[model samples]
Target: MGRELLRIEHLHKEFEGKTVLDDLSLTLREGEVAVIVGPSGCGKSTLLRCVNALEPVQGGSIFLDGEEIHADPRKLPQLRQKVGMVFQSYELFPHKSILDNITLAPRMVQKRGREDAEAEALALLERVGLADRAKDYPRQLSGGQKQRVAIVRSLIMHPALMLFDEVTAALDPEMVREVLDVLLDLAKQGRTMLIVTHEMQFARAVADRILFLDDGGIVEEGRPLDFFDHPKTERAQRFLNTFTFETVKE
Candidate 1:
């Protein structure tokens, strides 16, 4: 564990008068991996969105690296650069080449020279085993490959924290492993991450801490091994029993 990188205190959120999250709080340290898991509609994705400042909370606050997010709307663009987010959808520009898609942010937002941005992008692509696909478009790559490219795109920004919102949710069963492998590699590299996932095995394998959320609040949280093998609450037990398939590779 390292210094605190993200802190959420008394967080609250709602959509159209319906509560999605209520009084939730959490802390994540540098080089730590915290995985949020629970039944669907438990506010897992919404929590990630709040941390990324994509959703405005009704109360409480989120601080990333000591800077309060949502405090200054003007600084959001700069603040967002410190947090990289990957969604269930690949969200790639269909018309752009992989290289161009990955380098666009660094070039446009960061004002890095084209050569420098492209050089780093290509290196990241190669690291993810997609260097040869740099010339290809999103439509040309498989779902797994496109997702890997999305991860590389985020990495090029040099974000201090990465948020994954059900990244494998949209992938085909067979394609899940390739994408999860990249995440496992990142975990090995000690990148700080907060993930919302239903991939139980992968969650157990990668998480430094596990948060079991239900009805918009944390029901139980602890080490992955303890949570999986010995859930404290009946809610967590029932939730774990519902997943029977071995969707994630070892």
Candidate 2:
């Protein structure tokens, strides 16, 4: 029930004349984990990118902490720092060691001293259970480990909000949980997150609110349990039916 940390009104985005987002609107509050779920090409990732201003929207406003991000280049870097993002590809710097990958941003962007940045990075690496692998290159770590490192990299900036763009999508079944576990831990600590994911159990378990998108518009949204189990819209019900199968076996 805190003040809204993020507010999007009448959002729209198009790519080469094809509509990707259509009058989409959403809001998020401090410490809220809002998960956006939809089939491929449904603009889930685009929505996340727009929130952080990684992509420009043709229409509407994205308000981060009551400041507009879209259409304003001056605020881009600051907005990005306030809103950290973890992509599915991990996007780690291959040439840098894990420690460098984590520390580089805080040092370069935030301009913290090298010693301070390295200390923060080491602490984050240990928090993510990757302290022992700090010296390793991206290629040396498994997919899950790399994503974990990416998470730590984002954390070093101390973002007010985190956007996860399918961080576990590239991992094998056994590897997905490790990344998810870290995300869950962050959620437990009340880190605000906006996740674009295909992981239904995760959406159900962690999201404070759920948004279901299709054909460039939000078809439905509500509390995760109601949205997943008793969707009010027929489209949402059908979408959930397809995604909610394969019960997680213990």
**TM-score per model over all chains:** 0.97, 0.95
Which pairs of residues have clashing backbones in candidate 1?
none
Error of 2 at 38 (Å): 1.1
Query: Candidate 1 — what's its lDDT?
Result: 0.95
Model 1: lDDT of residue 57: 90
What is the Å distance of residue 40 in model 2 from its true position? Answer: 1.2
Which residue pairs come into collision in candidate 2? none
Pick by lDDT: which candidate is best? 1
Candidate 1 Cα errors over 4 Å, as ranges? 245-250
Score each candidate by Cα lDDT. Answer: 0.95, 0.90
CA displacement after TM-score superposition, residue 102 of candidate 2 (Å)? 0.8
> Which stretch of 10 consecutive residues in model 1 shows the poorest summed lDDT?
241-250
lDDT per residue, candidate 1, 1-250, as tens digits? 8999999999999999999999999999999999999999999999999988899899999999999998999999999999999989989889899999999999999999999999999899989899999999899999889999999999999999999999999999999999999999999999999999999999999999999999999999999999999999999999998986666987
Total backbone collisions, model 1: 0
